[model samples]
Target: MAAPILKWKRLTNATGPSPRPRHGHRAVAIKDLMIIFGGGNEGIVDELHVYNTATNQWFIPALKGENPPGCAAYGFVCDGLSKILMFGGMIEYGKYSNELFELNATRWEWKKLKPKPPRNGSPPCPRLGHSFTLAGNKVFLFGGLANESDDPKNNIPKYLNDLYTLEMKVSTNTYAWETPLVGGDLPPPRESHTAVAYCDKNGSNYRLIVYGGMSGCRLGDLWVLDIGAMLWTKPTVFGIPPLPRSLHSSTIIGNKMYVFGGWVPLVMDDVKVAAHEKEWKCTNTLGCLNLDTMKWEHLTMEMVEDSMPRARAGHCAVATHTRLYIWSGRDGYRKAWNNQVCFKDLWFLETEKPVAPSRVQLVRASTNTLEVCWGAVPTAEAYILQLQKYDMPLTPAKTPTGNPPLSPMKATGVFRPAVVG
Candidate 1:
């Protein structure tokens, strides 16, 4: 038990050659790179990797035009700009694709979107294990599975809870689809659930914290979506939360929300000669939900014994300010897998931080010479340290008498940089 601690740190010595095996694939982080796309290995996969978390390396994004045909349960994000979009999935014969692709890492290109009817059709429902998040510039799809004959016995594969909002209209650069101003509390049509987006300091708004999945059965319930006025709140926290799962993996730190692993169902009972042996067990537990004390924490692997990562379920963890970049998925035992085993490793969860020495000082602004910045601590305004103009080089070169880190008092005005050539 004390001997499985691969203390984490193996950023990718395998990305291409391991690009097949999949699981509800779709990763998105625009700046430091992590584009990933599509999934469902032995069948659907127009493939598109891009790891590079600051050069941890893994690249396979040749991007050509008209692409959105190869997929496996889709949904993507990253509107901080470099382009990503992607929508709908399930490709190859039993088809279902509402076509929409963007990708574009500065002309790598993909662009095939055309669902324009009242703005890209109101809300993602071409279905495929749904869940997507990217607030503040909008993009909030949820739930999934609504069509294309998966025939789970006349259920016709329709399990969507419906909640959509795209709204990224940068001067009609396109994307408008709205209608998720739920305002009346919703959360029921589950499909591999998991949605994060916090910041509700006493109702300043923005809180979409759903959890668990599979409404037909496995679900450890917990819901809240209150992006100010567009309501939905159900919080009654108190320790231990993470049981009854679906394709699991949720990440967010700052307002907490870190769930991992999934698949839970053990109904065995072959008593005499009858027949009953349902299965789907993969648990190395680790769930924490503390959107500022909505509590719930059960992190077992014998309590982070070796910094966990064994029981997987459609893997895709994403966080940075430190680490937490789990990739790939599907350890759902004997069911849906493309067999690349252990889901093609690439762990990295390092987080310790107690050492503090962060400073930043730059002031050349008497009225916009533009270099005004200040930081050294955060006695707290919730955190707002703004400083730009770094074409690269921030290791220890921000002099102005160097003790410079004094932001987080909301760091007052002035920030203008939208002149893109």
Candidate 2:
């Protein structure tokens, strides 16, 4: 079988108000837009950054109402639609918050859903690096490091394995949290792991798979939380699992979960003699976990021109159908880590391989006339060119002599050219 070639392309030359270089920030893709929030640079940042994936544009949206206090290591998750919810994070070295806030991406507004200490009075404690995953109407939050004290200044970090759910009443536009009575052998306390739900396209509730984090050192445990049963089961994962890692990001695309960029401990007995420079290493290696077979498969990734992002952890990754976008994370480790070395770059990893330049282009354009042309797609035989009347406000046109790289149009591949205006 041919290995999966990860064709990487770094995004550069983007103009507009972009967020400063930060780590521990979170990002989610809604429709065609990627929304970023929380995380830290020199200090914590509360502003919101939006990147238009289609146009390769960045805009720091002027958000209405109040944002959560500057914080990082919080729970930031998309509701798979137009809303993103945040819960519990550290404001600074000695301060943390358990406040929950909601951002309506469509309206670009922020509303505090559950206030600190919560109206229910039973919210999850102040924590960092927790999983705040949205599945259907319920958002399940699993393990993270938390401080048991009610005082914000007592920032002693304690690993927790407790579980809670916040269910949204979409009819009334409200939500509440419930501590589920979970059964089965509970996974150990940890933080910086990934908990992704295997939900339907419509965001129907499904299984929550939690994997890899750090307790004291790094962890490699695989745990599954069944939604209907309210139980946690440790699955015997097949194939060579990823090394014990923390602060990694994993996204479930279709039936496979893609894992990338995490702080991995490199003290395996088999690799004692390996010429590795560091005892711990941050890796940018990509691995796939097949949900159907409960097996992990190695994806042999081949990058074109060696353009992938470097090894880093605490970055955020989200998928738009077939494409994976990763942005900003911390790279070094231990005492060698420098705060100023955090990355601010953005990159796209094409899951498919050997990207060939598109055969479609704008052939000619005049003041009153425009002509577009395209050649056949490989193993395909049909093409369609769509020209819609320009209704959306157009910016002042740039150089009038450029062609946009073609967007793939899939069809029967059996018919000749057709144009619709």
Candidate 3:
């Protein structure tokens, strides 16, 4: 079988001042523009960077209103309006926040929302590495590390499995948070997992699909949350699944969810040492899950060595109709205190391609002649035709062919006016 064709091209000529090499940032597309905000390297980065997909240029717009302080690993989503909503992240190593902020895409302003009566008595705990997505008039948030301690000696972070939604009043332009009573089998508490909203064909049902993240170690589990029913279920899946990973990005395009680049731990023990030590590795492997069939397919691409981004985690990815944009992530490093390498470059994956022709037809023109027809292939320059004739099977009721009905005849021809007709 022929391998699937995929193309990855690193974007060049992104002019003007871009964000520094960082990770844990979030990006969202509004029309042709990509807005990137809030990541950290040496410290937290809170500035907003905008990239024009049409012009291939990057620029920072001066803003008004109160700006959120520098932070990383926050939840960000666009309301398909002029507003982009943000919530909950780590401002520093041991500090986390649950503040909500909005950015006016048109006016270039920031507004921190202060709800009079907070949802569920108070907002969700300050968190990082959570997944947030938009579905209809509501925004959903799930799973992240929270309640981190500032003390270096006891700096343990808490992972959560809770789910919350922000209900928006489109007419009045206000919103409220709601903690729905979810039932059924619940997934274990985890952080750094990714969730995407999937609406049914009739648009009557909405489902949020969650996949792969880390608890104490890496996890490769899949779960679904029915939005309307407020229930969670683990759907049985077929095909080879991706290995345990975290800090990856999953974007839904059509009936498939495309996952790109994350940290993968590889344990290597030294046999010679009395006390064997283990090592962790990271990868840039890419895969997709067929939502309709509940199957997983890992994609292998022909990538240029110099152009391909290194395997890393905490990066951000956003998808358009045909392309998946990956940008700004930390490189996979081994040591804790080692100077981490972050990327500022941008690259896109072209997931969709022209499909092969199908529904071929062969009509009998006469007793000894036939005409071949097929659907047009958009990317095909020409086509080939093959014809094979099999000998009739000998039976006891019928006379056996003496010469084995002669060798089956075979013919091959190029698809053209002279041959097809």
Candidate 4:
């Protein structure tokens, strides 16, 4: 059997108005359409761009109601209905907001939501570079940088580790914040991490899997939070792990969590250079985590240079049933200054399932000719046939055999047979 191959295809000739090159954007998939929200290039952007997966087109849809201000590093999620929920992000250099807004997917309208305060203290603080995951009717938010000082020159910011959920009240058309009382060990305060919701086999319990972030330094830890039990525990993971990174994207398909592209901080040997300058290393590597076996698998693809995307961070990735779409990220070219490069192109990572041909049959066509047939595999692009002759030796010596190798024959149609001599 042949190993399954993952292919990356760059989308071309996308029609309609394309969004400007920017990073720190947020995207969510609904059916065949992907909706992208705020990010920044020269400055912050508030325009909304929609990409149709079936048609390979892009368009800016006119929105109604009060539009949210231009911002980046915000949290966005689709409720699986026709609505997308957006939360905390930085609007500008010294500004961070905790405002919540909703986009009506079907009507193309926007509405600012004011959730009733939690029964306890105040709501979660204003932040950016956080993560949001939707499970059932609630959206979970965790870990981001909340600016504490008003001075724009003050680079140091406060990182948060608190977790909160926004529950929708359908009858009243409102939302309520709830801080669950969680037990067990919790992750440290960090920002620019990724979180994905995974359901168990029976579909009775849900878990939020978190991987990698930065808390003054890069992190490569894995933690899981049980929504029902209100517990947090670091799972024991096997296999080779990815390097410490932040600002990456993690998408869950089946029991696998696909992580791609992020920023890794660099340390310098010179004390003066280390103290005055800070550098980041961008990566294009991809990794997968198996939830069932608790193992990590790094995916390596063989493709041409132009076929793959550059090493980047602060990008957005959304997964469908069969494909993962990636777009718009900042590529830091390993320089300490003037190295930020924002992208405007789009790429698709195709994860094809392996399916072997079935109902195979063989028939003698002539004196030395034989025909082989099989049922077509829906997901397979090609098929392979192996033949062994009775006259050939069962075991080969260390010396060369000099025997002619068999070549593959191409057969078209669903049940077409290929003849061999």
Candidate 5:
């Protein structure tokens, strides 16, 4: 089922001095390559890693000059074109930078940017662990906690629900930015959520759906921004909302969005013996929702013996046209992580189209009898077959020379057809 590791399967240890181990670094695939920038593990790390998908190799094109320093949980969006933009991220000492950086593909360099001023209402403050989604040529950012203040301990944590957009304007050798404030009711402030872009109505209205994150407390609420109208709307439906979660992974498949495991709120015990007796509830459910119909459904394994992935949070999920890929993150109870086991396993989700019906033919045994034969339908939800019989008139002598009188018949039923292993 597999082959031994080859020269290409193994990669050389990273070049240049290794930076401090970091977490919450954001990655985006651009032109068949994955670019990963800073996250918060040590301080803000400025080193960037470029992974080549085709070769399974890691390449660090020697940095020519200054790059974005170590930051955590910043907004990283790769517009379909070929640019990866990085926004605010938290540094050591709990300081967040409002600086912006754009990684150029052709030159293989990073360019720092000073964002344009806001047009109307107060602009989004510099924050980390926010959500970013690119629609058309504009990138949208929403919801994260900003600088901490001590006016009052109870209300000092400012969780923002405001939305901001970075619009890229292309002109005759002149390129500028536009920051548009989103309007209408918005969801509560959230961080560490996933936001994905999907086109609606061919390419007219685009939808950016966000799910799972932490505000003052953890949340599992769903909110969407209509990219074309620049409005926010909440989805209302039946079934339990995904268990209150944060650091979960979500990706889109067609019009449906699938979310995997994440950490939920849990009580921690101060003593050892008491912790063992405590019953901890960590959700292991996988769920999805249809954006158009506002219908939600949870996924269950098809076979009883099928092995499922281990529960994890802070993992990342990315959807191709057909399959969804998941990467590593931490697992275990909220406060007590048994061990840090970052996963690198890849799984495939096979979705196939409905098979077409086979042809059917009718045989005539005599003038008054008929027999039909057809191959068994693989997934025969229902079947239809037609037959025609000849009818004789009372005055047979008149000699009806036309084709047999048509008598249509349909066979509709469920029969378990034979299946091949």
Candidate 6:
């Protein structure tokens, strides 16, 4: 139903120079813009590229303030509103850094944070491949690989399981570091694990869910940190946990944590090959964990698998109320003599809310402001207003986009909430 050229839409005029294929980059969403920073394709990259998710336009801004060092595999977290906090990362091919920086997305400014040292316990050591997670204004820094030797070429990685918090005073821009005394079954020291913040329906039990990472080798374990009780508990999960993986991307949408694409060993179902015939490789599999029940399930997209991004690792993914966006990572298998592939493409997967709203109504209160209402569902306890402004494809009007091009008005700006009641 569509022209071949239309099916192969490209960003030929992405404004500024296009980014080179890369891996290990960090991406964050600010409204409709995707801000991409430091990753390694050719050494470490420090340049910033912003892509308009709605318009297919790219703008590489010469930011106003000093940027973080050219780095990759660092601890990066966005505080939901505007502030982006980055912690330790690989400054160079084996050189690790422990400095922290904050980027004010509103002003496109950067400020290196000098945390006030804690009265007890040492601050986190230099690390890379760690988790920097945000719950409200406090940023949590967890396990990563720390180096003990100065020799970059011969340095041995020491796995870390330490936890620290950087409390941000948004108004004054001052920060304090704290080492919380945690109890219960502690997670083993590992790096490149996936961790996400979770909060229950009653707004109780803020927990951190940690999954598979590399210790001395790849591991498949799940651990949770109860922030309120300062306790760790390994919840009994249902179904098969994913094959041991690391360097994956995970995000919370509603009450589920969706994880996709990581360094996984060969799988019979994913590759359709015999067990012995398959080797370790990056995978494109998608899975999620229900925070309420602690269950894991592999998922497939509504669209065909061919349309999805290929197997990848070290990519970055972020979610809005109803969509997941993926960008830039290494692909291919891990072998001694094999050459891996890095990509600079961006992709998005649309997902319906677990509980969709019914009898939705909207009124234009003003030219820019709109009022919305919908029938609540019994299972839904939280709601987020997802605003989508349908835009014309950047191609010509006569372009065959598989449907009647903007000849008729299909522009809809409706609110889609993930958790609705």
Winning candidate number (lDDT): 4
Best by TM-score: 4
Better of 1 and 2 by TM-score: 2
Give all TM-scores, in the order shown.
Answer: 0.29, 0.79, 0.78, 0.81, 0.67, 0.77
| Rank order (by lDDT, best first) | 4, 3, 2, 6, 1, 5
Task: Give lDDT tens digits, candidate 2, residues 1-421.
Answer: 6674556678898878878877888888997788888788677888788898777799987788777788888898887788888888778765667788888888888888753233444778778888989766778888888876666576567899888888877677778778778789999998999999896556554889998888877777889988878788998789888887888999887788988989887776654422242467789888789987889987766654457788888898998756789999987667332263688899887664322225546655667875656653332223454444433334434444775422222222212344221
Which 10 successive residues of model 4 have the least lDDT summed?
Answer: 405-414
The residue-by-residue lDDT of candidate 3 on 244-298, one tens digit each, is: 6788899887889988878765752343321222444667888889998999976
Q: RMSD to the native, candidate 4?
A: 9.9
Please state every model's RMSD to the true fold in angstroms: 21.7, 10.4, 11.1, 9.9, 11.7, 12.0
How would you encode candidate 1's per-residue C-alpha lDDT over 301-364 as one tens digit per residue?
3345444556667777776554567776777468534553447766765433322324443454
lDDT of each: 0.64, 0.76, 0.77, 0.81, 0.60, 0.75
- What's the ranking of the predictions by TM-score, best on top? 4, 2, 3, 6, 5, 1
Please write out the lDDT profile of model 6 over residues 1-421, one tens digit for every residue. 4311101112334555567777877887777677888887657879888777666688887677768898888987886678788888999766899898989888889988798877697778888999988864577888999888899887788999988988966688688899988999789999999888988787777898888887755667899988989899888899767777888988787888878888876654653343233466788777878778888865544445556677889898877545677877897666321234787677766544346765456644565676777776533448877777665576645556566454222223355666632
Model 6 bad stretches (over 4 Å)? 1-17, 170-172, 267-279, 298-305, 335-340, 353-421
Least accurate 10 contiguous residues by lDDT in model 5: 3-12
Minimal lDDT window, size 10, model 2: 406-415
Worst 10 residues of 3 by lDDT: 412-421
